[model samples]
Target: MSQPQAAVGAAVPRVDARLRVTGRAKYAADNSPDGVVHAVIVDSSVGRGRVTGIDTRAAEGQTGVLKVISHLNAPELPPVEGGFPPGEPLRPFQDDRVRFFGQPVAVVLATTLEVAQHAASLVEVAYDAEPVSTDISVADPADEPETYARGDADGALDSAPVRLDLTYRMARNHHNPIEPAGIVARWDGDRLTVWEKTQDVQGTVATLSGEFGIPPDRVRVISPFVGGGFGSAARAWVHSVIAALAAREVKRPVKLVLTRRQLYFGVGYRPAYEYDLRLGASRQGRLTASAHDIRTENSRYERHSEGVLQPGRMLYSTPNVRQAYRHVPLDVSTPWFMRGPGYSTASYAIESAMDELAHELSLDPLKLRLRNEPADDESSGRPFSTRRLRECYLAGAREFGWHRRNPKPRSTRDGDWLIGMGMAAGVYDTERSEAHASVRLDADGTALVQSSASDMGPGTATSMTQVASDALGLTMRQVTFRLGDSLMPPAPGHHGSRTMASVGSAVQDGCDKLREQAISLAVRDEDSPLYGADAADIVVRGGRLYVKDEPTRGETYQRLLARNNRSHLEAIGSYAGASESEKFSFYAYAATFAEVAVDARLGLVRVRRMVGVYDAARIINPRLADSQAIGAMTGGIGQALLEHTVTDHRDGRIVNANLADYLVPTHADMPDMKAIYIEGEDYEADPIGVKGLGEIVIVGVAPAIANAVFNATGRRIRELPITPEALL
Candidate 1:
């Protein structure tokens, strides 16, 4: 089939937008099977302790309460097999130990949700509390620090003409989606089916089956729609297992929805970080060496780490580089991946330091970055697949009027407010995973595609449908894409910006196979108009198969299939993995510019305008890509000025767990924002040539805002959520 230029790059409307906007999309909590009951979890109040005794008699006696299960009465579950950190996963209600505050201690199942909640409140638990350490500053490192060194960092720092030593802290942040994590589990004659809110339906099936010691085929997971993920729902949390066990014990389907307060504990959050950095540079602002000492928060049971040191190791051309990453186990739950994950956190520190270096050398920040750009990945000694970051900078500078701003701090003032512009460079590793999809072409000249991927607000269904439509030589209306079910073709988790490159590739592969099948049938049919035409000369367009040189000699797919007595043609699409020749480093790059106004007297910082120029290869839909950029910039504004998850060290409890206390960016806080994509494609990245966009957009944003604040006020705050108090 000849590739069409229209659908792939066009700004097509989301195919599922109507279903989502009209409230017709079915989320996990919307699924309710016959004879369903509600389950409520009872959490411990202590930060660190052991359940000494439990009194569940009152809860069991409550009306409609079917069972009150605690560690004392809960059935034993098989050990969880595999996880990211390579540790035994946490099992609910299987042990007396309480590793953190708000840990689920018991569950109450009843005929109604209200009764279950009321009965859960009646269940009493006794605990022997221990001194809790939630403070990163006071906690001891759980193990030896992980270290990486490239050259003689100490010698280079000592001999450099200029030096800087800085310490930066980022507060923990939570993923508070409007739709809370929920699960509805049912078991029929040893077969388990769960409707759970998750990014990976297939992974959930495997996890639940492993926990229950059942074959994978016996477990099915369905999550047709998800409200939002942002990485919190990437894995099946402990509550999912609790819900399934409760349903089995009750012998009926059970529904469990986490309350707002419970969400703060049940789902994962971005971990707090303390980064100590030392940089040595030449008088021209070229970096000579960088030494990073990083400390992060994690639970005592499982060590959680991200790619925190990656930015320092490979972002620039430093010859002497060293890194030490340590996890300080605290009385808190294990942190999971959030949007941008490690790269965003690391970018704030590195990019802010870069801005400082620019100031010290009296150089434009963009020019200083350009001077130090690496020709290859210094850490791995590999050439880049494609790096258009310089182009992004040029485009952004031209469009954003970057040259008009005065480089001197506190130079431009209007009344009580100071105006300044700042920019930062952003990078994220291009990631791809193996995935599979199934495509079918019906005699009616329509196509159906299926994959067990997710659409967590990135327009996965719409983009994939466009790809399928173009590849199958059909109109947008002739294609239907289905996802979020374990029974469909297998796909990796939809986090890490891999859904497009992985699942989309599979969809393309499937459509290509199906198109080939149709072409074979058409060429072999003696009654076809172009019966003697070579298969290579055939081109399918608008459901019509014709010889490339003779457009008029063609027949509709419907007629061809009907004459052949075929109902439909089907094929399985597969992406094996990244190519073996991928010796080149792959990443998506961006240049983020921010204009901010600061009130010196009131210590108020407000972003006035923002522009993001990105070099993410091959944007499937410009409209959806812009949405991703704008949303990420908004999140960066929050991270720089508002968002913080406060913990009370005395009890290890989250102080501002609710929306009212925790702040995010709202309409008033949104600045005049624009996003521009650099024109390009990286076929080495994937068949679709997309390096991914969701995470990279947010990577350098916080630092850009921070640098702008410094340029306005002449004061730098190394801590995140740079509050007015910090400026004062």
Candidate 2:
């Protein structure tokens, strides 16, 4: 914004990229403390049953076996209260009930990794087998679905000349990163220290402190280096607690890393959804009414529901609308947030139904979407803080050759493939949270900044540093930034794409205050050349303050401090969300274009190219933001074409628990992906004039790909992960 300065809008490489790429960065598993004991978690065999007996005699007799802990022999712990932003506390080994498969039943401690592995197999468990009802054939969610309505949808649909009624099913997906979940916990009397793999270090500390009944200060969670989280590490799952408790029970430091298979059950996932959508529109593509019936799965112990009805109520300008969201409480593990959890699943249904409407009315898909863009967020009746969805649609269409696309299915072909192009609108809520930061300026003309925000491999630390540099009039090398420790300045947990908006603003705040502190000291001192100058008229460039009309009248901050006998100066700044979000409207929007080629004989669908255009407030780092968007598109392709977490309903066990059985996008499947960010700031959203982009990037991806498939083939698949069998 300021002539491409180091602040706000810049393409700066990550501050820690060298450490990460040089193999010098230390992840949690890389930490090896003296006298560290190895640990292994024994999981439940039966999906729904109670452990009647645990054979630990063999494990205890083996060499180097420190301890074997089960609910029968484990220590009494605090209760768990579950939900986000410090959900219910976690009590790992407090009970004997087996709620789902892969629930940790026992933890074995040994002197060596091999010894722990051998001893874990020796400690056996026998359970009373119960019926496993993990079937997805017919999702029978719980009673009393949450319902919302604004107008009479039934009456509008009855009077409309065009209508549609269709159902969509979404497959379960997992966030499998290269690094598995691990925790190294050490107990020093009543205090505990844990080097964990997590997204929210402060949240983990709070959960562990509450679970163990220890004071918050007694627990320290350090996660400087994380491979990748998606949403798996948002909270401290049961594995972390089990490892910490094992350390307390054994009187030694213990390290526990969940096996890849255990990851499917230990943490959370994107739950399966079954949605029935009904729509009414005019013959000219004007939407009149809509109805949505959504059902998603949750564990019996916890009542969780993804907000799949949000899109239907707001995306288009539909006057008559009714929606109900129901949760099916199955005997499965609790599901948590995944990338674009609600928006992705909901858009698939809404956009697919729109595609159906386009076919019936003989209208272009892009034209149909444009005809329905709401003048405002209809549900809230508030003007958007900013909306560039129209621009995205225009730009993406031009770049992807949308004008050349044939509306007729199976009309375009090249060699052994049928080529087609499709586009869909994507939307997501922006992030807003209370965040704080501290900045300290040393007399040597260098600056140090600290915050509680985290970098979940999206280059948050680097971006924050760049913001601090320009605000303080310092180079990137002159500023040192730190994160991922609870001891740093207090900040909200990083999620919802709010990190940059909230934390980056906080860093800017701190730097501004620090710079002001130096300027105030200089203006008040007669020894300084800028003595008695008005603070408003003084502008500091690279640590040297000068007057508005006279450049030679001011002196460097180093001289003012040296004459004042000061060693350093510091300031703490805080950023909070404004009340305007409630008074006005706020949402980030994107439009995606996808081109695909499907083999007519073998049903092999390969994407040729894809592009995403976003109106996500202001981008902090262009390069990193571009990468985030492209990676999100690639992930969406996986969700549309390959990703599925299969469960063996016969026994209520996840069958495709490992990478081999499950599928994700590899380099071979990657297409030529591109991203374009509209430049500007939404001042009503935050002080930093930015909105969130991470979650929205993937929201409309699956639908975009599905629409392209429909354009390529005459058939329209209703379900997700559209397999080759369906096409054949």
| Top candidate (TM-score) | 1
Clashing residue pair totals per candidate (backbone < 3 A): 0, 7
Scored against the true structure, residue 301 in model 1 reaches a CA lDDT of: 81
Q: For candidate 2, write residues 1-728 as lDDT tens digits.
A: 12125555778788899999999998888888888999998888889988899999999999999988998888888664554533233357677788888888998899999998999999889999888777655657777888988889989998988989899999988989888989999999999999999888888988899788889999988888788888888888888988889888888888989889988998789888888999999989999999898888887777756657778888899999999898887768888888887888999999889888998999999899999998898898888888888888998888888989899999999998998787888888886888899999888888889987777778888888888888887778888999878888877767778788888889988888888888889888888888888887877666677886797888876777788888989999789854643767888888999999999998889988999999997888899898799889989998999999888786788989999989999999999999998878898898778888789999899989999999999879988898888899
Please report how far candidate 1 places residue 312 from its true position, in Å: 0.9
Task: List the candidate 2 regions with Cα displacement exceeding 4 Å.
Answer: 1-4, 80-90, 578-581
TM-score of each: 0.99, 0.97
Best by lDDT: 1
Alpha-carbon shift of residue 345 in model 1 (angstroms): 0.5
Question: 1-728 in candidate 1: lDDT tens per residue?
Answer: 46665689999899999999999999999999999999999998999989999998899998999998889989999766566665557798888999999999999999999999999999999999999999998888867888999999989999999999999999998888889999999999899999999998888998899889999999999998998889999989999999999999889999999998888888889998999999999998889999999999988887777888888998899999999999998889889899999999999999999999999999999999999999999998989999999999899999999999798899999899998888999999888999999999898999899999998888999999989988888888999999999999999998988889999899999998888888888888899996877888887788888888899999988999999998999999999767666789989999999999999888888999999999999999999999899999999999999999989899988888899999999999999999999999998888988888999999999999999999988898899999999988
